[model samples]
Target: MTASHTPRAKSADTVSALERGLAVLRSFSEDRPQLGHAELVRLTGIPRPTVTRLVATLVGAGMLKPAPVADRFMLGPGVVSLARVFLGSLDVRGVARPYLQSLAEEVGVSTYLAVRDGMEMVIIEACRPRTSMLAARLDVGSRAPLPVSALGRAFLSAVDEPQRQQLIDSLRLQRGPEWDSVAPAMHRAIAEARDLGYCLSLGEFHREINSVSVALIGPSGEVMALNCGGAAFMFTEQRLREELAPRLRTIAQAIAHAIGGHLPALP
Candidate 1:
């Protein structure tokens, strides 16, 4: 898991200790699953003494366990239990799975349903063609950067201006000098989504991948993204725009309709 963007508490009633403890947990990721006290302190920018105490508390609470490597820790079963519960509670995932699965099998590509988590799109549901041996290996809980992935651009297209600007500003700050190089393509993707009702990322996020995605806005205005993608050679820009894009848009509309949200007009 990537670090979630948790906003700073402005109210006096918020618990700073709990916030710090959650930050400690968020420091762990798929690429860096195990961290020692010093690593956690550096990754989270918390004081060493505070990180030590927080790690001890988390270990005691079964949220962290000692790694086989000396003095390092891995996320524990408690985290899995919490994640299970959270995933189980998502009615939209249940509603979206069959449609996504059908899209995957029909197109011989992998499909995903993702929601924005801070500056990234986090996969809440994923499906791959049953007969396909070659597809993107993303699964539930996988994260994709918001500025490059089709899933992320679809999300950006669905959000209102103020929220989108806020996210763009944050990305500018986060990306620093690299924002100049990344911004133009991101802007084009957003425009494509708004105009065509879907966005395509052709060999953008990964050199060997191509994807098309559309936004699904829930009844309460919760925005999610749906994607259909596979190897770049298999899902070329022309094939995606001429073939897969319409199907992907239709699936998004079906999902929205099933979940009692306003159905998007098909192109």
Candidate 2:
């Protein structure tokens, strides 16, 4: 099922104003959390004059604030208010946080809980060990692309065949020529996930990272996924497949039970 907050447009005639506004908001990320007007123009490809007005409107709405370090802007309290409202409307996070946190600590890695949003997976919860030997740079609001992430492959495996094909078809259009080359590998990965109850990604997206993920039906009847991973050197492919995958699958089962979700049994 689709996420409630996922963007949608019924037709090509839909208003461009909201999309452009969101594009401006999305230009900020963990890597570039603050940006100046020029940087925003470069990032969003919205012309300088248009972006200037957009920035002004956002600032006026209290959605963007001036940065202390430089002549940049960071997302303001209004974004946090929006996030708070969205999170408060869901019980899954409250039910899953402690379990995910304990599991992350036990495994000494990063753990994530995410749901499909358009062609990507939006992280709803993420945890990292308090004293991790290796750092995995991910936060609750991070978005993982569908083509290359273990979270995405695991999610693809959990959905019905018809829906999966439909998504792939849409991806072909969205991702262009890259999807043609990536499809074979992704199909193999999804099938492997179906057999193993979890999917593995060894530097498929980020060369320095390796990950394992399992998708399950969420309490709200929407699909959600769990991911566990860290830096490549910290966990060998053999170790991830032989050891960590089982532990994650066990946690996936517990999460499934806790939230009235479906997690497949290992075959």
Candidate 3:
């Protein structure tokens, strides 16, 4: 029932090095950046030596760097460089990049490529709109709570029923630090998204940003998602409901088709 145990069981079944490296990277976040060897060991639950080795490797690779005047370390400049490389190499991103760019240009907002990571969605790629005041605001490697994000809900809605149910069950237990409005609102939003073929997050993740997302499924039925977000003041809820949702669905459909997903019948 513990968060660590649940994901550990699932990850152990797969045992991917890439996944482990990501785990290590995710261990360092806003709440706990600049970890020493002992903190890293406890956070990742990996052996101290192994964590040290991984930290060393990451530091050498530029994914991590030693802190200015402390033994603790933080994310290195190499992360952005590697992220650019990773984004450049993804065939899905490459194919969808032009469309996302066009969408950002047309709508004058920011767009993101969201991929599932355990029970969360990570923003792997993003395109900023030139006209928006929030252009280049969200960091590329940012993480979002699945149950609270339009992109995460869109990905969930695209999945098969049984998996969706299981995922929902897990998320039901993993609500954010605050337990009030965010949790109940997400439940309603997801249900609405299931009916509409796209999801919307209106100022839940941020006070001033509104986001709309649609799924981009793969040939093998894997679910990814695309998100478009902007200042809520500039792109009001009414405008998003009327204009952005339809545009997101169209782009998501094209990306899904390019990646070999059957287009879902719109409701």
For candidate 2, lDDT tens digit of each residue in 1-267? 122122345468877677767878877777788889887777666678988888889999999988897778999999999988987876778877887888788878899988887678889999889987665577888988787899999999988889899889877776766777788878888999989888888888777889999888876567888888888898878888998888888787887887787685447
Report the C-alpha lDDT of model 3 over 24-112, residue by residue, as the tens digit: 77777665768788777666667678777888888998999999757899988988787778777677877777888898998898998
Native-vs-model 1 lDDT?
Answer: 0.86
Computed on alpha carbons, the lDDT of every model, listed in order, comes to 0.86, 0.81, 0.76
Which residue pairs does candidate 3 place in steric collision? none
Top TM-score model: 1
Each prediction's number of clashing residue pairs: 0, 0, 0
Candidate 3 contains a number of clashing pairs equal to 0
Q: Candidate 1, residues 1-267: lDDT per residue as tens digits?
A: 122434344478878888888888877877789999988877767788998999999999999999999999999999999999989988999988998898888889999999997788999999999887557788999888899999999999888899999999888876778899889999999988988898988888877889999998999988999999898888889999999988988888888888887533434
TM-score of each: 0.92, 0.82, 0.79
Model 1 ranges off by over 4 Å: 1-13, 131-133, 263-267
Q: Please give the TM-score that candidate 1 achieves against the real structure.
A: 0.92
Clashes of 1: 0
The candidate, 2 or 3, that scores higher on lDDT is 2
